[model samples]
Target: MAVNQESLLKKYISKDQEKQTGQAPRRGPGGGPGGRNRGMNATGKPKAAKASVKRLFSYIGNDKYKLIIVLICLLASTVSSLGGSYLLRPIVNNLVAPDTSVQEKISGLLSGILLMVAIYVVGVLASYGQSRFMLKISQNALQRIREDLFNKLQRLPVSYFDTNSHGELMSRFTNDVDVIGEMMNTTIVQVFSGVISLIGTLALMLYTNVILALVVIISVPLFAKAGGAIANRSRKLYKSQQAALGGVNGYIEETVTGQKVVKVFNHEDISIEEFQVLSDHLQKSQMNAQFFGGIMGPVMGNMSQISYAVTAMIGGILCVLGKFDIGGLTIFTNYSRQFSRPINEISMQMNVIFSALAGAERVFDVMDQEPEAADGENAVKDGVMDGQVTLSDVTFSYVPGKVILNHISCYAKPGQKIAFVGSTGAGKTTITNLINRFYDIDSGQILIGGRDIRDYSRSFLRQNVAMVLQDTHLFTGTVMENIRYGRMDATDEEVKEAAKLASAHTFIKRLKYGYDTMLEGAGANLSQGQRQLINIARAAVSKAPILILDEATSSVDTRTERHIERGMDRLMKERTTFVIAHRLSTVRNANCIMVLEHGEIIERGTHEELLAMKGRYYNLYTGKAELD
Candidate 1:
């Protein structure tokens, strides 16, 4: 199956922050229906003999008893299969021959034949039941895994996400899990069946003709020797292939996110060319994996043919020596072919089992990752408070050696609107990120309500703080729903009130369906201003005591900015607000203004005081070209 199509086949895959928290499994019909979906890496295949067994039991986890029962049923069916084939000898020799009695002997063998037929029928039913049972087991295992991984994502610090690409994480949820699930539902079942058939065939052959059976077992080592080496080589190859796939996915994610730039700069052709290079690399690895894996069938088939021919010649010689009859030779020949059937199956499936395990390991690697930061035990809900914010001797870095915020200090009393003005990458937004505990400080403490912010649960910290970023993100929902995102339980009237506070209610009502209109993916249908208005309304409804407006009015037209500032005045009046704006004009009325330079607090005071200083802030606000 095309896994990518099914990857987004559900109602709609939420790629952003809509993941449900808690121990409950993710709601889903998951990972699609079958192995037909195509996509892999590694040489030195991890020994699946023991690890897979553990993972299988782990996959079964508490469902071990159920799996044991399934195995018991499989064994019984296997015994029945051997019994049915054994009965064929009597039915062929005694019931069907011209020398046999027309009635008496025929009737006796007929009853045995009927019993054998019944046994085969029951075994067929059991095999089907086992397959369905395993599928359900695999489905639940994958769902639980997806939910756990998502929760881990929530606890991870910003630096963790900063280090990894979104696409790499996505592969863990997509390609990796599917590999494990396919093994559980399909490959494992095949392995079980192949083992039973192989052992039973060898046993029945030995019972019929020992000489022929010994000859067949001789070449078994040859198949094992070749298969084992191919599996080992494939391990490294699969690892390389999966890593290449990650690169392709990362490219797609990065390019799509920057699609506007690509289009404007007419870089589509260049991007495609770059993509082709990665694609060619992936193709080469994939072709190698497929080429080696593909040869297993033909190689095994040839070995099986040689074994069958040898078995026939040996059996003929044994019969000439009066060690076996014609009927026994026929049965021995059938068993010889059966032994080869299982050998061929093992050779082919070994590749799939190894490749799948490698994929599973990559996924588990993500699941095994420790989140950089998480809430402390005994953390409590934040109490409502007058927003008094303070940061002292704060030091932070996205990377260990590169400090983004260095020994910085700031204070904002209750009901004060403190503005941070700087060019991009001057640590304006990083300051706001720290306030929400998106990343913890390397040193010193951030206090809100006169207590260290780290003392509060991360969730509680965020619940008390709100931010309206320059590039506003909106979920796929109605305008009203988007507004209510801050409070899921918010009533329509409450949402309307918040919209009014945002100066967004009037324009929203002008739309055909107004607040009831549903949005498509990422609010793409809405204009930039409309989306920002909704985001502002969301923050308003949140009723958070602390707020950060990062270039909030940058996207609006002059008239809209004037109106939004009026709304902003209503919103920020009673809250401790941090305004990070590139538009110095909009923040001119701030209670205080601070100038930042390279992670340092360069200048500070009220807007008027800074303009009076005629220093860095003065030059920035005046736009009078100043020499560096």
Candidate 2:
């Protein structure tokens, strides 16, 4: 019976619920980055099984020559097995012939046995060859799949990363790709060989005896009907099982990452309760899925046995009537058994095939997302940008109909220090984000070096802009290596100089290995202030013409902040700097300070000038009103 894989997938996979609901999917409690929707929606299923299969084949197609050899081996194995069984007819007839001598019968029996062994040996060798060749083909295809997926991720826009959690994207590389690999390694070959064996067995059965062939054929519908019913139920249960599994995994990841927070808040009991709920759901779904999946094998085997018994009884009656010889009856009965074996194998493998297709669909979904817009045709690819920046009536929004920055204008000439101070969500960071074109302005012109920012290629534009954000991140590498990450080709001496400029040199020398000291887990070995110092050193090494410090010293203590501020004074001397700080004292020496409120710059002047005006900036500076 032919399996309608596309139809079966449709019964399980459905559209993602996000399409219907205008809001993003709910994450775990406390807005932690974990949940079933991290990588894929729990309730939703993969769409377009046929398309996923076709695309996966395109990857497999890279090893077409090896695949062809594997196919030939499969054919050889199937043919050999079928041929060996068919030989039973002649061997039995010769041994039982009424006129044959005893010596002749013995000779015939021994030779037939030897020939059967030889054919079986050939079948074994062919099966081995197919397995060996298929291993290489599957590995090669998976390698390409991983490479493509990673490369596509690199080209995806910043907004993509902003919306999707890192855990979800990582799942494509791990769980999703792993399932695809499993399918390619085993299921594809098994299904193909099973189909071939089924066809070969059916043909031999018909050639042996038409009546027996009809008996097996009549039972085909029973097998198909039973398989379809079981598969229908199994697919739904399996879908739920996968979703529950994702939920359990996501919850575990979230809880573990926030163990410190959980302990501090005395929320361990609540966390345990939440985990129990998820684990219980997973257990129930897994039980149902396994029950249905496991039943397919025994059910098909029982039906096959019933078909074999009825065919055997009919064959015996025909043999007694002299309508069929005993030799023919023996071979036909063997073929009858072989026919249902392939059907059973195929039915059992359908679940695996369905899972792999769903995984492929998820992977393809990521690949199909539109990458960042390409560079403009006439965009500047190479030039030295002067430290001059301007924003003319810039309007912007992260979401449509919800403006975050409206008709804002600003300018900073060479070597000028421009500072932005405002309450949170008042577009202080948004202005700095717009300056580097992290998000393009809705309406306005942002010019750097007297040319529109859009006139320069994104890479070239970003090359001149350096930022030290409030959040510091470090990779698993030595202290020196992390510092040099700012400028890939910077020498060791240059790195140390940058560290000194950021006042991180003193701490580095005190570490056990100085600059060579190893850091891991985002520099968990270092204090938060030390991590921020290293981040500042990284930005110092960049030597970019324009610098942005968004709460760059926020994590440090007052003493450490003083040292960083002194180093930052030297670093800011020859570059145009933009600073966003909550502490009003940090912006006291700015060439110009812009006070922003409700995405609009409400005041602009030096510290004394803003104080003289006695408005929002003055109130914030005097502590008469909080900057919340």
Give the alpha carbon lDDT tens digit for every residue of 178-279 in model 2.
Answer: 878998999888888998999999998888888889999999999999997887777666655654555555556667778899999988987787666656
lDDT of 2: 0.81
Best-fitting candidate, scored by TM-score: 2
TM-score of model number 2: 0.90
**Per-model TM-score on C-alpha atoms:** 0.87, 0.90
> Model 1 compared with the native: what TM-score?
0.87
Per-model clash counts, in order, read 11, 0
Model 1 alpha-carbon drift over 4 Å, by segment: 1-53, 92-109, 205-212, 625-627
The best candidate by lDDT is: 2
